[model samples]
Target: MRKNLRVAAYAICVRDDRILLARSPAADGTPEWVLPGGGMEHGEDPYDTVVREVEEETGYHVEVTALLGVNSLRRTFPGRLLRRPTDHHGVRLLYEARIVGGDLRNEVNGSTDLAAWQDLDAVTGLRRIPLVDAGLRLWRERPAGGRVQPP
Candidate 1:
């Protein structure tokens, strides 16, 4: 089995009852709506990662306001050859962010293709990534520990 771990930062930007979201360009045909952020670079702080990723994916400069929470998820799936199983773990940092500059645009030839603001109530009807729900839960509930509580 092969094991991999990824640390990522994501921003939850909401204004006028709408939330900013990016559409993943996954080649596996599982594309879905996600928050505007991605994996951190080497030696990069999660705060910086959120800011940088937001700009890259949404073409908008963001100010990370508050740490919403952290989420950890793991999955095991077949590797390239479908022979070896790969274990993947992701540690994601969720933050509340505000758009400070730039215009809304989709990422070009990147992991994500589209960026848009969707109505908060309409989000439930959209096909979305799990992180979207997790981030929104953190924002709405605001656990004292800055982490999602298992229920």
Candidate 2:
């Protein structure tokens, strides 16, 4: 089996009873709602990655207010590109972010297509990735150890 590892950063921006989210491509290239962030580039800092990804996916400049927690997830699944079973591991840094500027807009020619602010209570009804739930948990709980179970 092949193995894959991904390190990513995400922003949890909540204000006025809503959270910012984007319709991002899932493992199968289908769109699903997710936090406004993605994987880090080679030699890129996670902090910078979160800022850049938030802007790219949501068209908003954000300042990370707090490091919420880290969520590590692992699974074995059939790989789309390899056409074989693979072990995938992901380490995500979730941050509490404050939107400082820019307007809400859909991402063009990128991994995510649509951006929107969903009511906190309404989020449970949306088709979304686990990261969304994990991030929100971290934000609400404010875990002292900065670690959370993968949702």
Candidate 3:
């Protein structure tokens, strides 16, 4: 049994009735919206990871105010970079972050194609990555300082 703990940080950056999202670029160069942030590096704090990732992905400095919740997920990728039935359990720490500095700009050297604010309702109809809904739901009905069980 090969199990790897993948810790990641995500920020729910909201301002003026909209949320900041990174439009992920597909292999064919298509776009799909997702929450801003990414994986945490070894020995890095989750709080710092969220701030760093949000800035790197969305070009905005964020101040992580509260710890939302954790999510555990399993993924299997075949014919991918990661093979051999690896159990990737993620401890996703969501945060309520306020944009403190940095201009909103699409990172020229990054994974996403677009970095901008989008209507929260607009997300309902659009095709989004899994983490988007999870992050939003967590942001809306935040836990009473506890963990969110996996469904």
Which parts of model 3 have CA positions greater than 4 angstroms off? Answer: 26-29, 79-83, 145-151
Candidate 1 local accuracy as lDDT? 0.92
Q: 77-124, model 1: which lDDT tens digit per residue? A: 776755688799999999999999999998998889899999999999
Task: Order the candidate numbers by TM-score, best to worst.
Answer: 1, 2, 3
lDDT of each: 0.92, 0.92, 0.82
Model 1 backbone overlap count = 0
Task: Tell me each candidate's RMSD, in Å, in order.
Answer: 1.6, 1.9, 2.4
Model 3 quality (TM-score): 0.87
In model 2, the Cα lDDT at residue 23 comes to 94
Which tens-of-lDDT digit does each residue in 1-39 have in candidate 3? 467888898998878889899888765667788788888
Model 2 Cα lDDT, one tens digit per residue, 1-151: 8889999999999999999999977778877899989899999999999999999998999999999989998999876775879899999999999999999999999988999999999999999998899888999989899877654
* Counted clashes in each candidate structure: 0, 0, 0
Q: Which segments of model 2 are wrong by more than 4 Å?
A: 27-30, 79-84
